[model samples]
Target: MLLQDKVVLITGGSQGIGAGAALGCAEHGAHVAINYHGNSADAEKVVAEVRKKGRRAIAVKGDVADASTATAFVKAAVQEFGKVDVFVSNAGICPFHSFLDMPQETLERTLKVNLHGAYYMTQAAANQMKDQGHGGSIVAISSISALVGGEYQTHYTPTKAGVHSLMQSCAIALGRYGIRCNSVMPGTIATSINKEDLAQPGKREYMEGRIPLGRLGRPDDVAGCVVFLASDLARYVTGASVLVDGGLFVNLQ
Candidate 1:
């Protein structure tokens, strides 16, 4: 009950890490607004699951990458829940390609969705939180690639790095208002984004060997860290990047 009676808005929350965060927040007694760009069915399922747990939940459809949509999504959440206590900027894309062979469109799309989207959503949510007079927490779902560049993920790495930077700046600028911002950098999580990479027979094994934990991370691993950051337990923590990479970044020599 660390987040009891809190209101949380999680972007890209229909599935994967976002979905996990929505569920985790709800389980801790937070009323959650699950935002999904597409896949309304999946979003509904998450809402249902949250309600089944005796918590209020809603599925909000909007593209976080667009400023208008992001603003609308935040507005809807505030309309339903009165005010937002936590905002999780988890919407992102990773269409990997070699640095030399990367397409401009792909790079732009990655930057827009991963970095710009987080910026707008955070602004909208922070504004609402400030008006409420209680302040709030902002969490961004970055990746370990922000710390250690990935070979075939050139475009994605930069966006994540940008997110990390954004979190630091926002934390500093908003601290006066009791608002906290932090980023979570996850490594090799078993999400649909990496389905193709892990589909190969030996690929999953190869990745597991690199991790000190001897296994790929799960969505819940990242979600747990996010929930903690959004809770009063982390009230004194801000402008930090929590690494949930199972030692992958540290072990890389």
Candidate 2:
């Protein structure tokens, strides 16, 4: 009941961390508006699960990389739910490529989706919250790679670092309006995007050995942090980067 009756919109919410956050919000009595660029079936499944929790839920479709589309989706959610109380800018792409052979196309696309998408969605959502005369929460899903550069994530990690900076800036710029902004940096979460890589022989064991928690993170690990930031309990917790990495990055440092 931490987010009772709050309206939350999550982009790329059909699967992985996004989907997990949507369900978590619903369980806490929040209405979820899930946005998915593709895979209508996955979106529908998430919507159904949210409804099963007896909370209002809807699935929206749009490419978050398009500023207009991202803005429109926020408006759509506001129109459906009356007003957005929370916005989770969780849509992003992570493609690992060594620095030497990283293609220009890959780098550009990663920046567009990971950084630009969050930028637009957050700006639009913040404007809506300001116009409504009530404060709201914004949680951007970043990565631990932002703190510790990965060997194969040269193109990817920069975008996440940008996301953290973006969150802090938004928090400062919008604090007067009672808006809160923060980022969640997840580490080695098991998601469809990285399942193949993590499932490589001996990979799981090696990763677990490194993490103090001795296991890979789950999507719900990040989702739980997002819900806390979205709730009034975190009212004084703006401009913070909540790490959900199970001590992987900390131990390394």
Candidate 3:
């Protein structure tokens, strides 16, 4: 087990890629703490899954956009698991809309949840890891959109780019303390958030055709990378961006 006996924390972990990472870490022998904004049932379901894997698990309810939530979430994890070894900043939202008619509320909420949320949680986790004196890993769930434009994601792409940038800067700032910060950029993952879009006629097939892998991504696809970065196998890895996009970006002509 790559993460045996380690403590891992994740935000927006009730579903999608975050939930996948939660279960993946547990399978690798880590006690897990998850944060979800709403939907207690979903959060508890993930906790149950983790426990079924024979790993200790807890679900903390809170909105990552709130700075205070970050502190409380970390405190709860420490209170339950003792220390934080891996922190995955995976909480985010993308409300697709035409750039011209994008709602102010949607834009603001996206920035708050995707960018500010990652910052606060990462900062809180880094502080805990530093105090523990054992070093830690931080993985931010950036998007492939960070490298390319999206017709309906004008307001969302910048936040991801910011997240990717965050890891790069934090990797430098926390290097002396042995904290590694990295970002994983996933492409067109088949999560609930985008299920409707993919459901559109021919949309799914078109996307699959574009990717060299010939299939859309699953939550586990991104989770596996998170697991690797969290493990000692990547001990020397830091300030990096790993693309879990299945060749979609490269397939571009």
Candidate 4:
């Protein structure tokens, strides 16, 4: 197993990509920790799935936007699992609004949960990894929206762009400590986060035709990449941005 015996913590793991990644890591022999904001039932479902794979698993609850909560969640994981070898800051929220009338509160909320939350959550995880002296991996879930800019995401895209920036900066700052940081930028994924919008007439069809690969991405599509970055296979990679966009990036460009 690529991640044999490793301890991995994934934020927002109750469902969607986070849940998929938790299962992926567990299948590869990593003890998994899932942190959910407000869905214990769903989080427990993920925990159950991981345990069925014969891997140790736990579900943590916290609002990643708060630094103290972020810190506490990592500390709690360390308490249960001894140490963290991989941290996936995957919790995110995207609310749509045009720049002309985007509310300040909306922008702030998006930044707090997506950008600021990830910044400190990963920092706390990095500290744990450094203390262990084994080095580790940090995978920030970014979005192609960061690169392409969204029509209704004037306030949202910057936060994702910020995640990419954070990955690059941390890759440099944490390199000496043997810690590596990178990002996985996904495009038009079909998850609860976008379900309502996707269900609208023509939305799904429009995206299907737009994406070069002829479909929206699944949670597992991105999960596979997360496992790679967190595994030893990506030992030499850091500050890298892997796109799980199914060739739409180059097509629509």
Candidate 5:
């Protein structure tokens, strides 16, 4: 149990990669605080599953994109668990549109949730970790799109690139307090968020063809990396961006 007795907070944890991280953390004996913005039922489901594994779990409802709500969510977790050992900033949104025709609001919202949310969440969690007098880990969920810009995903790319940049900067600023910061860049993962598009035969084939691994990634694939980074096993690692992209990012020319 690499994370035995640790406390983890995962934002946007009701589904996709976030939900997967909650479960993985629980499996490793970490008490998980699952935060969901608009999906209380799904969040509850994850909480139930975590409890079934004999670990403490709770569902917290809040919008990570908002500063006040992110602060409150961190407060609630600390109230229940005494302290936060790991904070995973995984809340994000992606709506694709051609760069030349993308709406201003679309771009703003993407930055708000993907980049600003990470900022607020990390700020809130880092404060708590600093007060606890023990070093902690903060993992941000970036995307391979940040490394290799995607067509029609210009807005998302910048936000994710900001995440990677944030990780490096935070690592340096927070190192004095024993806090570590890192980012995980995931490739095409099979999640409900993209099920509609991936269900189409042509789109599915095109996505799979780009991966050298010959298959799309799964949520657990990225979750596994998140858990490792959050564990003591990665105590000496910080300011790093680990790509769980199945070689897709490398294949980009």
Candidate 6:
């Protein structure tokens, strides 16, 4: 019950890592506001699960790529929960493509949704927290790709790195107000984002072999860390990037 009675907001929370974090936060006694891009059905399901935990929950639909969506999202959460205590910038998209032939639109979309989206959402949340005068926590869902690279993730890795950097700088910018900023870098997570890629011949096995843990990561594995960062347990933690990669990073060396 580390987050007991807190108000948490999450972007791209319809499924995968985002959904897992929503449920994890609720389990710790926090009311949740989930923002999803499209898929209302999936978003509502996550909201239902949060309510089943006896915590209040709501599903917000919007594209994080749009700057206005951030302010609207925070406003919606405040209207429902009275205040914001934690914000998780988890909405992102990754379209695997080779660097040499990467389409302009693909690169642009990835940047807008991943980096710009996180920036807008974080700024909006920080403004609300500043106005409230109680400070808060902002956790970006970065990736191990931020530290390394993938042959097909040329356009995606930079966004993750940018997100990780965003948290570090925001930690300094928002520190005077007691707001903490950090990131969780997951490695080889098995989610829809990589379902097709992992299905390629030997792809999944090859990835597992790279990790010392002998397995790929689950959404919950990263969710637990998100919950911890959002909770008072990490009150003194800021400008940090915690790896939820099951030692995959060290194994890479």
Q: Which stretches of candidate 2 lie over 4 Å from their true place?
A: none
Worst 10 residues of 2 by lDDT: 92-101
**Pairs that clash in candidate 3:** none
lDDT of 4 by residue, 1-253 (tens): 8899999999999999999999999988999998899879999999999999999999888899889987888888899989999999999998777888889999999999999999989999999888999999999999998799788898888899999999999999999999999999999999999998898999999999988899999999999999999998999999999999998888875
- The lDDT of model 2 is 0.92
lDDT of each: 0.92, 0.92, 0.96, 0.92, 0.92, 0.96
Clashing pairs in 5: none
lDDT of 3 by residue, 162-235 (tens): 99999999999999999999999999999988988898999999999999998999999999999999999999
- Among all windows of ten consecutive residues in candidate 3, which has the lowest summed lDDT? 244-253
Error of 1 at 8 (Å): 0.4
lDDT, model 4, position 212 = 84
Q: For residues 1-253, what per-residue lDDT tens digits would candidate 1 score against the true structure?
A: 9899999999999999999999999889999998898888999999999999899988888877789977898888888988899999999989878899789999989989999999999999998888888989999998898988788898999899999999999999999999999999999999988999899999999999999999999999998999999999999999999999899988896
For candidate 3, report its TM-score: 0.99
Q: Count the backbone clashes (under 3 Å) in each candidate.
A: 0, 0, 0, 0, 0, 0
Error of 6 at 95 (Å): 0.7
Candidate 3 positional error at 43, Å = 0.5
| Runs of candidate 3 exceeding 4 Å displacement | none
Report the C-alpha displacement of residue 242, candidate 4, in angstroms: 0.3
Deviation from truth (RMSD, Å), model 4: 0.8
Candidate 5 wrongly placed segments (more than 4 Å): none
lDDT of 5 by residue, 1-253 (tens): 8899999999999999999999999999999998898778899999999999899988888877788988898989988999999999999888878999899999998899899999999999999999999999999999887888778789999999999999999999999999999999999999886787688869989999999999999889999999999999999999999999899877886
